[model samples]
Target: MPPSSALRRFFVCPSHRAFTLVELLAVIAIIAILAALLIPVAGAMRKKARETRCLSNLKNAGMAFFNYQAENRDRFPPACERSTGSWRAFDTLLGYTDATAELLHCPLDEIPRVRSLRPRSYAMNDPLWQRESWPGVSLNDMDNPSRTILLSEWFVDGNTTGSESYCDLGNPGTFAHANGTAGNVLWYDGHVSQLSSASHDTNQQYYNFR
Candidate 1:
């Protein structure tokens, strides 16, 4: 048995004392502040992650275009050359890439213009409308392949007619992400980049293929 003094000291130890209400409230307040600070940060992180994923998907789509070009005599598939059913332009890349159909979808895509039957979230630049010079013009004819837009994160309509019908990112909602403005561009040279939406003019040299 311990001495009475030792028992009293043990029972009354400050370290073992219960927390005061004020202390508890302070701790809770600190936690609440931390959560308040972290929530938006966490959301921003998630949005950035989805943006990265969307870029990766565009990269895969670029690969598919390259592969399609390799087999199609260096010519890109027609954006809307099809005279038939409800096929979107990206469908022209389906079998060319080993990536599943999921690669064609952007994680940030919410306002899809077309049905999910073919599951596409990117739209091709339409050179076919201006001079009927899209799939007809081979990649060899491109002046600056690195700058020429091939595909972008946007909504697609039918087998053709996407993004802007001209590759202009001037619209407010043209290249929208889940949160705000974002434009993920896949160039003709098989590279992916985040481009400024308002930075491009429809007739900019970068948009010119010839």
Candidate 2:
């Protein structure tokens, strides 16, 4: 025989069950734990994002040099202007490319534009040409353009006469994007990559390709 009507009704419509206070607290605690776990990850992501932007700026700089070189019979821009005999590649390139001076400034560099147009955060490779006779040299005469560096983060060591060079290796501020372990370098062949502090000075060719 089938069950009574009252029994069938009870089975079909069971009373709603409310979560206990402890269960609600447990769910809130779980959410809090997950949030705490993501904090560091979020910070790292933001750092990497800034790093990508810095690299893009460096890449733009390298391309500008190429455009400069093509029009001047493959000769790279001068490391310093002859009128003042000071390393001001930024100024020289701006004249050639008609790009805003701030495009060459590193994003991480907080120096105000009014204080310094170039911000002293980037410098050209010293081996690309001689300060005395740069126009005579050409990129076609260089070797290993793929491995050679074009420009990198600057390192000021009190003696800045030839200090506007890409030799700011193994410094905390130079590699701001990588927690000071590695910094981004734009190679002569129009590619950008990270250069570790240890390997920065290991080979003379890394900086001195000429």
Candidate 3:
């Protein structure tokens, strides 16, 4: 026997239901909790991306040093200029390598430009070369090029304020890193690595080339 039209209509018009207040609130609470959990993870991913970029910049800068040396009697630039500034010394490589003023700036740096020009984020290891009173160090002078630190993430501290781009291992506490605990360091052999602040201070080998 076939169903009646009224029976079909009754089945088709079955009652509809909507979420109650409690169910709606529970869904909203779940979304909020998930969002809260993901926020920190998103922040950490951003920091890691910035750190990776910083490492690339340091690596390119290290290559620039090697290129600069190849043409300039195999000698590294002075750690910093005595009269002008550290940026001035690094500027000497502008024509030698593919690196530009923009490449010298770190992605994590809050202060992009201090003076009219873009401020440098990396600093040459001051101990890599002798003081201004003595001559600059050459590749031949390094006892172990693989272990020597050439350039590192630099920042200003209490004693060294203003737009300066030089890292003195003597003041290890002043060294800054995007990760907060360790920094990307460029070695003379043209490799980049992350060294913890504690290791950087305790291990004199990173600071001393001899």
My TM-score estimates for the predictions, one after another, are 0.73, 0.68, 0.72
Q: What is candidate 2's lDDT per residue for 103-168, written digit by digit as tens?
A: 666666653422322355566665565464645357676578777777777454435444545433
**Model 1: what TM-score?**
0.73
Worst 10 residues of 1 by lDDT: 164-173
| TM value for model 3 | 0.72
User: Can you write out model 3's per-residue Cα lDDT over 128-205, one digit (the tens) per residue?
Assistant: 654455566788877877777777775445254322335422333344674477777888788889878677652344
Of the two candidates 2 and 3, the one with more favorable TM-score, higher being better, is 3
lDDT of all predictions, in order shown?
0.65, 0.65, 0.67
lDDT of 1 by residue, 1-210 (tens): 766987898888577789999999999999999999999999999988988999888988888778877887876666653333233446667788777878977887765443424446666666632322344458777888787777766543333323344332222224465344557788877888877656644455235766
The clash count for each model shown is 1, 0, 0
Model 2: pairs clashing at backbone N, Cα or C within 3 Å: none
Clashes of 2: 0
The whole-model C-alpha lDDT of candidate 3 against the native structure comes to 0.67
- The reply for model 1, stretches above 4 Å from the true place, is 1-15, 81-85, 116-119, 128-136, 155-173, 177-182, 205-207
